[model samples]
Target: MLLKDHVVLITGAGSGLGLGVAQYCKAQGAAVIVTDIATDKIQSLASEFDEQDLLLSCDVTKIADLERCKDAIVQKYARLDAVIGAQGVFDGNLPIQGMSTQHLDQLFDELFNINVKGYLLTAHIFADLLKQSQGALVLTTSTAAYAADGGGAVYTATKGAIRSLIQQLAFEFAPEIRVNGVAPAAIGNSQLKGPKALNLDHQKQSDIPKDAFLNLFQSISLLQELPNAEDYGALYAFLASKQNKVMTGQTLVADQGLLNRAVLTQSH
Candidate 1:
């Protein structure tokens, strides 16, 4: 009941972390509005939630669609207590050398469109409502934000931009609203290993060298299990809760201490 009586609007709610958060919020007593571009996926997902009161078709990359999503939430709930901008994409693992300018440009545009631009637009559109509720924004960045080659040129930049955006939003929004982000390690749910539209298994011939990935896991410490989308829901819930009022403009690392090990001494 951490979020009891609150209204949370989440993007990318069709699947993965977004879907998980929506459900978590609903379970915690929040009226949830789940929005995603994939209508069919979201509809199917909605069935799983059994909360007919939550769900919308929002393409975060499209301003009109985002506006519609926001309007729907305001109409139904009157105000938003929290917003989670979780619509993002990792279009397979392509290295800088292997990537064409066209590929990089297109991917960069799309990633920022959903990740950075989406967050900005959602914040602006919901800021007034959030101010009324003293709400917060929980953005989903990633471990990729901290490393130059964590994802790829495009993904890294997009995540980094999101990291900065969290701080900026927290500063601009001030005491009325809080802003924060979570940086997770590789969650093993990326569409990167799949087809052309990230639907097929392309991991067999991924552009990122296998050794680079192996080295990352080999050096990791803490829990051995792979991180999952559902694991993020609780963290998101906490950040969006009233208990976290003093915590803002910070990025929480929930990667099983992956980054901590990165900088830790071997002796430790």
Candidate 2:
């Protein structure tokens, strides 16, 4: 009940880490507003929430759509306690050499629009509301932000931009709104999709071979196990709660000790 009576807005809440945070926040007594591009993905899960917990169809890249979501939240709750930007698309690890120039351009636009610009727009649209309540902002970044091979160059760059955004915005919004991020690696059974420009929009991380994916994690992670979407929810919840008073402009890396293993092996 750390978030009791809090009003939280979350993007990409239909699946993956976003959905998990929405559920956890709701369970902690927050009025969660869940937004996703795929309405059908959230329909089955809708019954579990109360009527006050809204599930809206939102395209994160569209400013109007985000504005509409903001308006709805204002109309209902009149205040926002937290904003979680979780809408993102992967690159399927397409190497730069493998992509044509035109394909690379399209991929850049698609990924940046959703992964980087989308987070910016969410903060922009909700800034006034958040300031009114002195709310917290938690953005979803990736382990790819710091490590190579987590994704291709483009995906890595976009996540890096997100990490930068969190720090810069924290400095700007401090004393009124706090900003932070969660960077997760190899979330098991994630429904993360790739950009359509690369013809990977239909691709789901869950579609990959489970055993092979697990094996890949085992090869790199000191924990030797993939973290689940729910494993990340508590981090988001804590970042969005009053409990995180002294932290901002920082990212919590939840990568199953992958970075530690990488450094250790390199030293050996």
Candidate 3:
């Protein structure tokens, strides 16, 4: 297995991409520490994991919660091989022209807090442990960073920030730890929700009509199918593994060829 004998931490693993990657890491023989802010999700995950794995209600944006998680990990395994940051929020795809100043202000804070700040805090809190192990940090960005209409303005901006953060962190932590990012195009099972500022928190990317989404996605990219969460698992597993010796300070575009063509040529 790629990650055999490793100890990995996955944040925002209550559902969606985080959940999928956590399971894949476990199957690859890593002792996984899965955390999310949802208490019910944590409770539900308990039965699937033995005492060997740690599950907690961790809010990534809060230092105290992250510190508690770090202490528990250090007490249990004493070493962390990789940290996969998978928590994020969608910006409801509402263009800036449609939003008022108040809407934009609140939306920016909410999305950036969860989507950008969460990764920043996680990296800061866990840097020492990862450095000790000379491990890896795999962050999640999006195809929005490269192309237009991948998300709304705020969401795209947050992703761009993450893409830059990956490079900076990789450079700072170099010769010891690897920092990288995965920018996925379309995840078939994405539960990425929107900001509460515009009252769009109830909306999720996963709620899209499957057939319509598939048809639109298929028409644009060379790869006709929308990749499922598990399909991206192996790539994450590899990046978080010791086998990643050469690559660093980069964001791999796992976009299934979506950005290669004129997918956004007609967008205003």
Candidate 4:
């Protein structure tokens, strides 16, 4: 009952971490609205939840599309309690020199638009409602914010920017709304792996020389085991709950011990 009677909206809820959070929120008694661009997947996931009334198909990169989603949810629930921004894309691994300028430019542009601008749009549209409810905004950032080669250069930049955005927005939105973020370590269940997701199979064939990406994590992470997408849900739930009142403008790193190992290595 951490989110009892609350109305929570989560973007990128079709699959991966977003869907995991949506399910967790629903189980906690929140009236949850799950949204993603993939209509069929959203519908499929919604069927499992038994509450499609709160499901929406949204493309967070587009302000107007997201507005439509917000409007629909408001019409049904009349109030907004919390929002979790988790929609993002990663084109696996390609060295900076191997990556095409066109690919890099387009990917970074879209990445920032979705990862950063999407948060801005959601905050703007939902700020008033969240202010009224004294709700929280939980954004998803990655451990790439701290490590250069954790992901692609562009991917790293986008996550790092999101971390900074969370801090600034927390200050600007002040006592009315609470904003926080989670910076996870290499998550095992990624959309970046499959054909329908980041489509890494074809990507590896095209630009990247390696057969598989994400090998760098093994060497750097002391824990050796990568976290699953579902493993991150509890952190978001905690940040979204009233239990986290005094913790705003902050970030939690769920890296399974990679960061500490990195720090120790640097000191040595």
Candidate models: Cα lDDT each: 0.75, 0.89, 0.91, 0.77
- Ranking under lDDT, best-scoring first? 3, 2, 4, 1
Residue range 214-245, candidate 3, lDDT tens digits: 88888777787788887888988999999999
Question: Candidate 3 has which clashing residue pairs, if any?
Answer: none
Q: How high is each candidate's TM-score?
A: 0.85, 0.96, 0.95, 0.86
- Residue 103 displacement (Å), model 1: 2.1
160 in model 1: Cα distance from truth in Å? 0.6
Please write out the lDDT profile of model 1 over residues 92-174, one tens digit for every residue: 55676776676666666666776788888888877898999999999989888875556667778888989998999999999
What TM-score does structure 3 among the candidates reach? 0.95
Misplaced by over 4 Å in model 1 are 188-221, 262-268
Superposing all C-alpha atoms, what RMSD in Å does each candidate have to the true structure?
3.9, 1.7, 2.4, 4.1
**Ranked by TM-score, top first:** 2, 3, 4, 1
Between prediction 1 and prediction 2, the one with superior lDDT is 2
Pairs that collide in candidate 1 are 193-202, 194-200, 195-200
Candidate scoring better on lDDT of 3 and 4: 3
Candidate 2 per-residue lDDT, tens place, 1-268, comes to 9899799998999998888889889988899999999979768777878888888899988899988898888888888999988889999998989999999999999999999998998888898888888889999999999888889999999999999999999999988999999999988899899899989999999898999999888888888668888778899998998778989999999988888765535532
Candidate 4 at residue 2, lDDT? 80
For this target, which candidate reaches the highest lDDT against the unseen true structure? 3
